[model samples]
Target: MSRLRSLSPATDEVLGEYEIAGPEAVLAAVARARAAASWWADQPRKGHLLRWKREIAGRSDELAELIAAETGKPRGDALLEIMLAVEHLDWAARHAAKILGRRRVGSGMLAADQGAALEYRPLGVVGVIGPWNYPVYTPLGSVSYALAAGNAVVFKPSEFTPGVGQWLADAWSAAVPSQPVLQVVLGAGETGAALATSGVDKVAFTGSAATARKVMAACARTLTPIVVEGGGKDAMIVAADADLDAAARAAVFGGFGNAGQTCAGVERVYCVRGVYDDFLARVTALTKEVTRDAYGPMTIPTQAEVVRSHIKDALSAGGRAVVGGAESIQEPFVSPVVLAEVPADSRAVTEETFGPVLVVNPVGDLDEAVRLANATSYGLAASIFSADQAAARAVARRLRTGAVSINGVLGFAGIPALPFGGVGDSGFGRIHGADGLREFSRAQSVTWRRFAAPIDLMRLDRNPSALERARKLFRLRHAR
Candidate 1:
């Protein structure tokens, strides 16, 4: 570790910080996790899951504090994250038996006498590289599910918030007391790269799309299976007859909450022309009411320039700033920025502005809204505010994304039953619900003989005429 550097919420000045992990440290931790995986996988699912849940329940407050301190998110939000993690853990534990249990499968007619079955098995040791935005919830989407699927985890938290990862590992160690099934390898890019290249069974990564590409390439070198959960340029569309007040509230909460550091946060808004003005007014008012505290600074300092560039592009492209202008950025904390009349060509319209900025565009109708919403390279989660369930489902099916919310923003992520992930440049594989649980494990097919083998069709002693007669009889009976 290197010397600590202090960081400011504004002005990009340093306040306080610590060094990230190195390659050696990451490798050592991963090695330990690999050694412990067998013991964890050998444990009964019922007992291991109970222990995991008890650990989370016992350390709820501590986990929230650690998450808040490391991510600079509000305590309430941190608590919400922990709650979601616990919920997923509970769901995964209870449902793992059914979701991964072995069941019979019908073989083709050629192998009718033989019975086949498929099952899900643990993937030994799994590596997770988590983002700093939602330290507890996001990683646990993989961590809890992986544990339930019987894999030991070697988690590498983002360099921006390594402390959070360390805290989680510490708590697990304290709770289990049997073996350190969960471990943390804290560091920077080198540490993450080390984990990706290590001999882990699989890697579950969540971060920027560019970084996801690099991670994928590194894993490719070792032919290791991976699940890439890159960031999203999520959008929320307001229908012509939509409730402006409700849509505005959701847009503000979804876009600017947690300093707009959410992967599924609202980056773009396509409002129906009939209620565009009303929606914008309400959203602007909501944006103004949000206040930034000293605790929640920009967790990723380098993102400051990225935010600035998006704002500049929107302004230059003839977009009017409804709330935060370029000057509104106050360093570690940024006031909410709302842009209207933004050109479709602007970066704010096409790219993932992972900040407190929103671009609101008007469409003639729901069809136009759908077209504009699906224009981006990244397609993660999306919101369609409409009272008509049939219309919402129709629009959702045509949107070409993973999860779609009918009357809410990012509701699919909150629903433990729904699979949460993205498509296209946003990356593939889900991180929540049943899909998430299986991502950390491999499907194992098994067959056990219940009866003696039938004829000796493969034996050299079998006559060619006998096989020919059987084949002709089978073909004659099956012919249409």
Candidate 2:
């Protein structure tokens, strides 16, 4: 039997070997989920799914340990991810019915005799492909919302973090043990592709832009709608009037947290020329002080090579590291590195390094800051640090990203009700709040004739007189 291996990134220990679900197994899993979807969907108010969310909250530590072992993140970081995932799950379960419920709408004059209603229906089954960096929180962002919205889910977690996926599925089954509301197929890209084309109602993929393209193309073959969350080349813009201390802290935490493997982590910092020196000093000091002992190993082995390549390219392009040099990157781990004067065209600036690296560049003005920030192909999430609320709002409004944190980094992602996703290369479709609920459901507009009208436009009885009156009324009301 073919198996997927899970290794501990921190100690290079073998965590466990998991069965690899092939195309046939994936199709069978989806078929089981399809059969169970209707049963699960028919339950009112998600059949105590809210309680299941509470279960996750209660036992999050156990799950977090599992996450830590598989992904090699610290226990603290793993718990944080689980905590947020539970919060989102609870929010989704509580709000899905209200968000997708039937709502009355006003009938326009043309349909004055008819009663109009709008409602959303479940999309049956959803296939989710999640990344390894944020295995618990990121995947649950889609899985929880989909389950709450009344769709059964078939989740394909990153091969590096398959244990987290198993925990999620096992937890859900324990909560609602009646059926297979959510199923997981474990393997690499082939397994994911199989799930994508296995006739699921929709696919929500979270990973690299290149991989997203493949997933998007595969789903297209089946005419299946997909939500692509293709990671981010997220940036932080420090305006002239920004809070230097707060911005510095945010930059350090955002850039170094989770070994800078965050999809929304601050990869680039564009500072206005006025306080550029001061801001750079603060960030560099803080980044240097921040220790990597708490940071676990990089989940993906090849990712270290990518980070090294980007750093080498920046150095080759005349960029300088203020805090850490090329020596900072080692196999399975990276130390926080503060880069200064990196070329905008450098790979570290243009692409996602996904390591404990930050490239800070001085901008002549806020306009230049915004322009440089928007120059990236990715716009998943960004941060704006400014003391002036109005100015911050203005600057944040112009960033070409999905979510922006005005005063802090990753503040928007912690908000359970806000939508999370990106545009352009970062990918589209949202996965939280009302938008998230509707994303898993299909809209249905219904119109019915409540009663007889004085003159029925569709009826053949004396419709000419009514038409003449309607024309007269239009002419009188609308004509110049």
User: What is the TM-score of candidate 2?
Assistant: 0.98
TM-score, prediction 1: 0.93
- How would you encode candidate 1's per-residue C-alpha lDDT over 143-198 as one tens digit per residue? 88888888989998877666677778877777686877898876778889999998
lDDT against true structure, model 1: 0.82
Candidate 2 lDDT over 1-480, as tens digits, reads 798889888777888889999999999999999999988778875556876787788898898898888877789998999888878888898888888999999997767899999999999999999999999899899998998899999999999999888888888778888889888899998999999899999999999999999998999999999998987888899988888999999998888888889999899999998899999999988887877776766778888889888988998999997987779877778888888899889999999888888999999988988899999899899999888889888988998999999989999777889999999889999998899999999999999988887566786676688889888877887796
All candidates' TM-scores?
Answer: 0.93, 0.98
Note the residue pairs that clash in candidate 2: none
Worst 10 residues of 2 by lDDT: 454-463
